[model samples]
Target: MKNLKMKAARAGKDLSQQQLADLCGVSRQTISAIEKGDYNPTVSLCIRICKVLGKSLDELFWPEE
Candidate 1:
């Protein structure tokens, strides 16, 4: 699966991993893992990220094909 691209958006918004994690109710490590493609976030986490980034879930998380 293609990994989701989140770090750019976070950086564009000037949000640190900890800040994003706090907003999403997840740990900093979770944010790191997701950004690094070491972990795949659950649907709930994806929803929260999309909300925070002001993007649709389809824009943020989707299979390559």
Candidate 2:
């Protein structure tokens, strides 16, 4: 899995992990795990993230092809 470009993009928007986590209804650790490629989030989680980031799921997560 790719390390999260999501975090980078969020940072570009000046959003902190805690802020993003709150917006996404998840923990900071969950955001950290996602950023580190340490967790494969559920589809629902992915959708939440994408929605929060104003991105589509495909823009955030690509399969390991």
Candidate 3:
């Protein structure tokens, strides 16, 4: 599934995909792919993204049931 929560959080923080990717040391396309559900990030990358977004892993990556 697409990671809309992460996208929303990024928007909430007024960050573009490029900005977030820079903060997380990744490419904009990588960030886009993650949001599009075409990429599954590594645990360390997930933590980095969560930290930059001021969110927890569960909040950003966990599926809602």
* Colliding pairs, model 1: none
Against the true structure, candidate 1 reaches a TM-score of: 0.85
lDDT of 3: 0.99
Error of 2 at 27 (Å): 0.6
lDDT of each: 0.83, 0.86, 0.99
Per-residue lDDT of model 2, residues 6-37, tens digit only: 87778877899999999999999999899988
- Alpha carbon lDDT at 33, candidate 2: 90
- Estimate candidate 2's alpha-carbon lDDT, on a 0 to 1 scale: 0.86
Off by over 4 Å in 1: 1-4
| lDDT (tens digit, per residue) of candidate 3 on 1-65 | 89999999999999999999999999999999999999999999999999999999999999999
lDDT of 1 by residue, 1-65 (tens): 33446876788788999999999999999998898888988898899998997877776776556
Give each prediction's root-mean-square deviation over alpha carbons: 1.8, 1.5, 0.3
Best by TM-score: 3
Q: Name the weakest run of 10 consecutive residues (lDDT summed) in model 2.
A: 1-10
Model 2: colliding residue pairs: none
Q: Once model 2 is optimally superposed onto the true structure by TM-score, how far is the C-alpha of residue 17 displaced, in angstroms?
A: 0.5
